[model samples]
Target chain A: MSYALSTLWFERQRYLPAVLAVAFSCLLIALQCGLLLGLFSITSIPIDESSADIWVAHPDVPSVDLGIPIPEAWQSYLAVPEIAHTEPYIEGFAYWKKPTGGTELVLIIGARLGPDSIGAIRQLTPELRMLLSETSSAVIDEGEFTRLGIEKVGDTAEILGKRVRIVGTVSGLRSLAGPYLFCSLDTARKFLNPPPGQCTFILGKCHDKEDAPKVVERLKAHPRKLYPFTTQDFSFHSQMHWLTKTKAGIALGLAAALGLLVGAVVTSQTLYSATVASLKEYAVLRALGIPRWRMAMMVVSQAFWVGIAGIAFAIPTIFGIAFVGAEVGAKIMLPYWLLIFATSITLVMAMLSGLFALRSLRMVEPVTLLR
Target chain B: MRADGLPLTPSMKAWGLTRSYGSGDTKTYALRNVSLEIYPGQIALLMGPSGSGKSTLLAVLSGLLHPDAGTVLTLDKDLWAMNERQREAFRLEHFGFIFQGYNLFPALTAREQLEMILKWGTGCSARDATARTSDVLTMLGMSKKAHLRPMQLSGGEKQRVAIGRALIKQPNFVFADEPTAALDWKQGQHVIELLRAAAHDQGSTILVVAHDARIIPFVDRVLHLEDGILYEGEERPMELYGGPTAPSPGYIAQ
Candidate 1:
């Protein structure tokens, strides 16, 4: 065995407490962050999956929830040579009639279902296409279906005083702040029936993503006065608007930050205490001709192993939490990149703590071992 | 005095060594112009009163402490003039140490302790180090307790394990500070014989600092010290009992 491995093995018993502490802290941070990211994904599923490269709305459209109505003529104006296609989308809330004749409020989104449809609902699940193909068919997010106790396919529900059929269930398309229901444009317009020629927003897709900025600028200068945003800009605005304007988003973000800070502090303190407790052993090792850098390596290696163990423990714990949440009709989705990010953060925190704690080794004098 | 006059061949030499701790009026002298030569294949015992510099002299000779005003040459290389890293490497490669309490790592068994020393001090591979550790433990009569931790062994067994650890690398010299101070008469005698056999049979130089006096007869030469001054050769046998009869001065009977 190498010197580091031998030294670690020799002192494995002494280091176990510190390793467990760090691992537990990492698990807490990963689970907290994972839950928060999962919630954020649920909130933005519609916007993230939109086919439009740009969105045109009235000035200062509050959010997707509070979309402002614009002239349907704006769609034709936005369909310039630079733009590939443009379509109008409507968003509103409606009371859905349960199979038992009870009623529940849900957020409703309306879009074309053909090739030109933004296909936000279909992006959630391929099965949604079959549901949207029928004129009166509507797709309800799995969370909404469970919350309202609507089980069988082919069940009919009343949306905004209009009858609609529940043809399919889409996964991960629910909004925690509100239930989500998806239906085609014609059915939605018949239900909403705003004054003739008005829609919530006009969504435009460009031939190339690179052409998005130009299309947005051209639409912004249209004679009718509209606010245009590229898809990326619109997504950012929506996310920031929710984070800054809503209490739920702010509370979740703050809780996540606190979890990260607590994890870092707990891990760092545990490592420091372990180092102090083993100071004499470190002196003996130094006296035996182990280099300072090698001593530092021992601490860092211990931290690294602890971090790995914590992640190993955390993966299953997070999945369990998500599963439990799903059983109760809560929408929780863990993205792959979020887990990767959490692990990276955990490892970096561990390394930083190791570096800080190993500084104690430098103060050790070999002569102290003689005493 | 030099070892040239005697038939013994010297392995470590100290010339006019001096060391003091602290500074100004509070300065305390731990060693004062002390000089001694320890020869190969012999055990040298350092006897002294409390605060008489036996530990300081051992530290200087072993390169664990730098002498304030003198030279310590081990195997003909000046120890104090070397940098810290160089001195550490030199000590690891050439010196072995046995402290009073054995100082074995609590987490490791006796065999692991020996193997660690061999692996670190000699850069030996794991298999070779383990083999060497087993051989040394067997030679030291500690093979049965090889897997036991220090706490599991009796006082004498622990000391034997410590001896095995010290000799695992087969260094040229061994420096021990009061190896038997914590042992009873029987255990102390066994430890002394173990050190003697290690020096004679293994051709290694052994230097021990102690005031125990019980193990003095087994040593090849005795260097006595008083108030940081060294006196070569043995003192008058009566003078050995001049102070308190305990192992160390001020050490109350328990």
Candidate 2:
């Protein structure tokens, strides 16, 4: 080991608090960044789960929420040379009457009972799909059974003043707003009372996924009151709609950034104080004729070791938090891109704090050793 | 006294060394019009009471501190004429220092302490430095305790290790600030004798600053400082048992 490294070992007590501070900062940073990424991921789920390439919605509808339902005749879009097929889906929000007679808020969605239907419900097994073809049949996520007071698949509930029966349960479908209750288009139209022969979205399959841009352009040129978006384009716009127009999205994003900012400040202050305390040792080296750069390398070495150790500690901690979040139907997803980004941010923060700590080293004069 | 022995060539010389802290009426002078010459192959003692600028003079002469208005020369190279980088290189090439409290690195074992100095002062590889460290430690009577850290060693052992650090590079000169202050009489005398032998054997100039007169019977020349100025008293070499056993290594007859 270099003298720089050995010095840290000798002074471990003097440097322990700073090391832990950086570790805690890493945890908070990963937590916030991971949460933001997960939020963005789930926002795209409605788009990602779809097999269709083209989505038609209200010209200004940025998110999944429906605008005034449009006429269902948009199926004529399939007749376009670039288009293959189309399906209409209904989406809205309503109150769910619990068994206790109290109402809870819910997002309600409806689509045709076919594999080619417009919604992204993974729970619609062949059996469930046949069952959902019957009116008054619906499905709810299995994870929320306790929260909703439902004991089994045959449990009944009331949505929008219409009696509904849960026929099946699905996994991996969750929303931050509340639980989702999926039913048929006919049932949705009869209960929520949207205009007859109308749907909030028109999903279109393209002959070739690559040709979607051309299809969207052609559909746009033909005079129709609807907007055309590739599934990706629609997903992005939907997420942006929520992010730009709603306070919840903006607040969560700010909170994530705030966590990173606060972590850096706390860790930087702690490391800076530790560097100040070691100035005397640094001065002794300087007086002994060690170069100023060598002394700086000493401080940088300490910071580097601290950063590595902090990251080691933060990985398991963040994984535990994510696991706990999953149990409550809240997902704290950490995709590979987020992991790489967080790791880079961690090293930069550590190096920046190291540089900040160097500010105190400049004050260490060789003359201090004389005293 | 000089007729008996005075160097025709000196290792270091300073003229009008003046240093002060603060400014305006509140300013206090640590050194004023101080001038002196240091000779080779001899341990010289500097004595003074508190706040008399004994340590300040040592700092200025050794290139550890810059005087407000003065000039210092070692081996005829102007210590202040060079920039900070050059001054640093000059100190590494020419000077070694032992502080009163032993100022040894608390983390480094006894051998590693000397190895740190040897490697940095000479640009040698760690293996080579470690090799030399064992030889240097043995020379200082510290071979058995080379692996112990400063805190694990006693006061005298620490002082001897400090002396070993000063001697490792065979520097052009060594400045020790109160080398014997922390030791008892026997340890103090032993440390002084070690420094004396190193000076006699290596021909390196050694200057020690202290207030303890108990160390006086062991040095070659004694100088007194009172209020930032040297007393310029008569120069006399201390009587010794059979005199300096070995001729100074780099000495030329005057």
Candidate 3:
């Protein structure tokens, strides 16, 4: 074996407690961040899934939680010379009859199946177009189906007192605020109501993304008297609205911050304790002519092992929790970048603790070996 | 006569070495103006009572502890003038220490312990390091127990392993602090013989701070210490008879 590997192996048994602590701490942090990311994903599903480059809503629609009515004819108005396509979208919550003959709440979304349909919900599945074409068809996510005790694909669900046949299942496509049910505009209008010309919002797609802001400004100035926004602006406003107005969103943010802080402190303390415990060994090494930098490398190596082991132990458990959370109608999305960021944070915390432990190492006098 | 002078070549010399602990009225003088010389190829013992500065002198001589006021020259190099880093490297390159407790690294086997010294000494490849370790273990008659860790070995075996560590590096000098204190009479005699042979055959200077009378007979000269001053004694030849010798009456009195 190489010198480093051999020495590390000899010292490995003494560092078991520190390693276990690191693993458990990493697991805690990963699960916390994963669940939080999952929650954020659920809340932003409509915005994330929408194909619209611009959105037109009421001047103060607030968030996905609130709905504002606009003229459905605005779709034709937005389909101008510069605009490629436009569609009117209906979004609202309604009670649906469960497969078990009970009732559950879900967010209902309406969009046409055509060249101007925008395909926001269709992004959830390839079969969405086929399902929406059925006129009486509706698509519900797996999380909603599982919670409502619905197993078979053809099961019928009663929304707003009208029965709609389930034509397909969409996975991980639930709305941030509630379980989502996607259907044709006709079915949505029939259930949600004031006839053919009324809709909740207008979604417009442009030929060039750079033209989105100009298009939104033009639509806002139209005599139809509507509030319009670029998709990015609308998404940002939606997130901010939820963050400031909803108790669940605020609580989740607080919990995530607290979890990060506690994780850092706990990991640092554990690593520092391990260093102190091994102070004598470090002194012996110093007396044997090992430099301070080599001693630091050994400590850093220990920290690295801890961080890696902790992340490894945590990943599966986070996925399992996310699956369960999804079933309960909470959107738990695990983003790749977020996982990488959390691992980096864990390494930084471990290194910080190592710095503290180095103080104890420096205090060791080689002459103590004589005593 | 120049204190067994024979034209001292200053292989290891201390001048006006003094070390004191505490301050002012409460001060304790561990060593006061102590000076001595140990020539190469000599096994010298520092004999003293408790608190007589034997350990302090050894610490200074080995570059482990700096003296309050003195210059310790080993092979004409001033020890105290070197910085901590330099002193540590110097000690590793030129000095080998064997303490009373054997101080063997608990995680290492007998062979590994000796190999650690050789690796540091020669910076050689593993194959060469192993060869040197085996050679040294054979010389110390510890080849059979080379695979055993300190915890698995008897006190005598552990001390023998320590001797192997000290001698494996082939340093210019070796400092031993009560090396045979933990061993029985036969084992103690064996350790003293090993030290004597290391000096005679390897031409290395050996200095030991010991109160054990069992080791006195094996030393080439015993320097008696009353307070911290060295009082030179007559040179004595080592008596390596087979059986255990009874403890000295003076030690029994203490």
Candidate 4:
């Protein structure tokens, strides 16, 4: 065993605080970022739940939910060998007159209810699609009924003074800002009423999912100045828009920084005191003419080991907590890249703390060991 | 070669040495124009009262503390003339130190305690260090306890491990400051006997700083320090202690 590792093992009781502090920092950073990512993920639900491989939107569409009208004729722009099919998608926010005598803002999403359509969300079963085919019929998330001021799937509401009946409800499709009303294209047009022959976006399906980026690239040169994105790109763009608009990333950054600061301080102090406790033994080595760098290396090596140990403890706990969060309806996204990022930053913080603790080695004076 | 018919020569010679502490009205001298020579294959005991210049002299001679004036010429090099790095390198090559306390790392076993010196200081390979550490532990009668840490060993065993650390390099000079201060008389006597063997068997120059008068009979010569002044006591014959009879070296009168 290495001297540093042996020493750390023997004195693990003394170093526990540092290990725990590092673990806490890793946990806090990962969980907070995961929760924020999950929150922003909701903003891209329209793009994520669709079968479309590519989306063609207005030139300045920042997010799927915030899209502006584009001429439905632009669907022909996606006419390429890589594209298997195309359909017009209409979406806009409208105020619904609740039967309980109040008005609530709700997003109206309209798509072709055909089985071969690329714009309809996958949650719309054949029965629900057939029910939605009737004019002025809509489906919503079961959890949003309270927010929409409705009692059940058969309840009726008014959008723009036009009566609309809820056909059915789906699970796990809740929205962030407004309740989503999924309906047929004619029903949504009756409510949102974009200018004739215009839609919010034109979605395309590719023969091969990997060809979506190529198709999007080809559409980028269209004279109409269209915005084109693969489904994954569109999802990411939508989430990024909401993230920056809400300034939630800055809050996450501050929270993670605070965790790192606390971890650094505690870890630095722990290493400092441990080094000081061994000063006499180090002084003896110094008197025997061992170079100061050797001792410094040992301290830094201890810090490195502490970081590895802390990260080992944290990864499982992060996953476990994420699992619990999912069970309780709190979405926490622990993507592989996020895990790597959290651990990498945490390891760097620990190494910096090790450098900070090196100041204690200066107190080792060989002459003090005599007499 | 000397008038005493002894083939003696000094390996380390320090002259006109002076060291002081503090300054102004609070200034006090620890070594005042003191000089000494320690010969190879000889165990020289330096006895001094509290506040004497014993440890200061040891530090200066071992290249650990610098003297305010004068020079220490050891192994034919001016010890004080070398830069800090050079001095440290000089110590690593030729000097060994045993402070008053054991000062062994509590986490390492006895064998590891000695191997660390060769591995870290001399950069000796692991196999060589392990072999040398085994030999030293055997010599110290500590081979059986080589795997024990400081907490697991008795005080005397721990001190023996410390002594092994000092001798593991086979340094030309070994300077011990009150190595027996924390041991009982029997353990202290055993400690001095080990130092004697290093000087007599290994032909290393040994200088021990202690206040115990009981250690006088175990060493070949005794030197006393008082008020920063150094004094040489009468030397004894090597045959009396069954040690190798090296030529007698004369001391400079203080």
lDDT per residue for candidate 4 within A176-212, as digits (tens), equals 9899999999998999889999999999999999988
Ranking by TM-score: 4, 2, 1, 3
Worst 10 residues of 2 chain A by lDDT: A255-264
**Which has the better DockQ: candidate 2, or candidate 4?**
4
Spell out the clash pairs found in candidate 1. Answer: none
Local accuracy of candidate 1 as per-residue lDDT tens digits, A64-179: 76676778887777767777778888877767777777788777778877755763544545557656766767777766766665776777877666778888776767676668
Reference-based lDDT, residue A291, model 4: 91
Error of 1 at A304 (Å): 2.4
Q: Which model is ahead, 1 or 3, in terms of TM-score?
A: 1
Candidate DockQ values, in order, are: 0.22, 0.38, 0.20, 0.67
Model 3 regions lying over 4 Å from their true place: A1-14, A44-108, A114-281, A315-338, B1-8, B111-131, B141-147, B234-254
Reference contacts preserved by each model: 0.27, 0.54, 0.23, 0.77
Which has the better TM-score: candidate 1, or candidate 4? 4
Compared with the true structure, the alpha-carbon lDDT of candidate 3 equals 0.72
Query: What's chain A's TM-score in each predicted model?
Result: 0.65, 0.72, 0.61, 0.94
The positional error of residue A284 in candidate 1, measured at the CA in angstroms, is: 3.2
Which segments of model 4 are wrong by more than 4 Å? A210-226, B1-7, B234-254
With candidate 4 superimposed using the best TM-score fit, by how many Å does residue B28's alpha carbon deviate from the native? 1.6
Q: Which is superior by lDDT, 1 or 2?
A: 2
Error of 2 at A319 (Å): 2.3
The numbered model that scores best in DockQ is 4
User: Where does candidate 3 clash, by residue pair?
Assistant: A23-A310, A38-A332, A38-A333, A42-A176, A43-A176
* Model 1 chain B: worst 10 consecutive residues (lDDT sum): B245-254
Instruction: Please write out the lDDT profile of model 3 over residues A1-371, one tens digit for every residue.
Output: 43333444566665555555555555555666566555555555676677888888877698754667777777777877777887788877777777687777777788766644673554645567766777768887866667656876788867777777888877867565557778777777777774567788888888998999988788878997778888778776776676566666567556655655565566566666656665655554455554677667656665666566566666776678778877886656566766677667666766666665566667666566564
